[model samples]
Target: MSKRLAQRADSRETEIAAVAADALEGRVPAGSLVCGDPDGVVEAALGGPVWNRYAYDGRPAQPWPPEGAFPGAVLRQPRGWGAFAMTLHALAARLPEGAPLWIYGGNDEGVTSIPKRLEGLFGEPETLAIKRRARVLELRRTGAPARGGLEDWREVVSVGDAELVSYPGLFAHGRLDPGTELLLGALPKIYADQSVLDFGCGAGVIAHTVRRRVPEGRLTLLDMDSVALHAARQNVPDAAHVLSDGWSAVPAKRDFDLILSNPPLHRGKEEDFGALEALVRGAKDRLKPRGALIAVVQRSAGVGKLFASVLKNVEALAETPQYQVWRGGV
Candidate 1:
């Protein structure tokens, strides 16, 4: 398994593992929906595929699980508060009356107050278990979900004159990220007819800016996360949107003149740069000769070292206390 999958498997041995195991074995039921799957560990424990579907092609279609289609759902709390709130509301909105929704995570994963968060929608939640430094809570929907507060998590925002659609759980959902802003500010002038790929395009903010700045460039937005891509489509309607885990999923024959990214470095509360490293290591092969790869990465992320290990030359284009934009070409 990859590092991401390995970390998720390791989490299954924690305090709430036994309860989760038991719930997966019987209580959660087959055909129940699973949201925010953590490395397919939950799906494997459930013993088969469940009702897990993702929105496609940056479209808002099926953004939430269908209402009352399943008796219950199992959710792994996301690290972001916006993601957590959105997940909670989405689960509540879809679950049938009296059906249970279970949320599980460790204290270190930043999910200790989930029960409190669910109280308004589901009344007092039931503490299922607390062990091995982890906690599990169950809430049964008794009435329609209280959705009055969910609008905040689903609002679109204006970033540098671009009206970008954002949803909870997307990185920097409501606004532009500083790293992305820095990258946009420092983007080298694009020559005519260049093909640009926005790798890990979150909410299409970078793609939107690139298209505006380089109108002659053909833009393609790619991201592993369906929600991010969905948001991106709204921001850059004219650009192509590709759903991909990494370079592996991109078309083998396609090459780009410019590649851009604000590569993800975190999975929940855990920091893992393997994905970013993979992108850096494989980037040169995907670019045409004289083509460049540009990215905004955290200064402490060792991105310079990663780039230096793979590329002959890596140049720092712009810097802030929190981030830096780096560019390199074959």
Candidate 2:
């Protein structure tokens, strides 16, 4: 896309958000709604692009959200009516009626359900134009407004002897991701104070685990999505982070003591393996002599072939019914 066209597109996303914001001009929404999506449009417009949902998405990239805490002012919750409870609680605190309640997402992500959910929360919703994948909703105050607090969607999910508290859009929320499990199980012993890199750390499972096991090790994480990177920071404290597409920003000559990743396959219409290949090509050069590249992938994805061709030595181990754990060392 041309620079001017891209700027206009970004501007249009804001315009789309304004439609719903205006709909609630009279009162803060008693409830809110968000879909299972990563479309940057909703938060981008409502509050500015301060919130990122695409980070650590099922991809290997760097983490870029600044390491910090965000105001709970903008409440984030799960899909469906649960979001209503959190949104209502936010409104109850300070944002008043006509404060303009909002719900956002793409069409494919079930933004259409926002209108229906709003019908139950406040009243029928007023919808704006449909975009590529989402929609927005604004509720009228004439409808019933029940008191709702944050308790609506809070739940504990099991993650390998751990109970993780989650609300919405947290990867495999309330539970552990399969790929993450594989990566965790494959972690090799590394000395403390060594620089370790999480190539595509998502939800920070690997990064957090590494931090606990090797607190002295300088942990550096990378991911593609802004939201995932943000979540990673929250999940894995004290680790250095970068946001980019799978070590794309790291110089080819830069070396690391260890690299871990679960490479992503889907890229739009085609499944691009470039990230994995790039990892293999640069990993050898980047490693500290005997540094390792640990990764996991589905057996059907034929990760073994790539590992064999890329590393000085490749070891394949079975983690689960579907995953193959591959570790390459120089």
Task: State which candidate has the highest lDDT.
Answer: 1
If scored against the real structure, what TM-score would every candidate get?
0.86, 0.59
Q: Give lDDT tens digits, candidate 2, residues 1-330.
A: 123433454454445445444433333322232222234333443442233334423433221222332222232223345444444443433333444444544354356665555434445656644554445555444334544333354555666766444554445655677877877876777788578988777557777778788877898887775445666676676888787765566777646888888776543223456566767777887788777888887776677777788786889854688888888888
- Give per-residue CA lDDT, model 1, range 167-244, as digits (tens): 877778667788898999898888668889999997888888877777767899988776777778877888888777
Task: Tell me the whole-model lDDT of each prediction, alpha carbons only.
Answer: 0.72, 0.57
The best candidate by TM-score is: 1
Candidate 2, overall lDDT? 0.57
Deviation in Å, model 1, residue 314 alpha carbon = 1.9
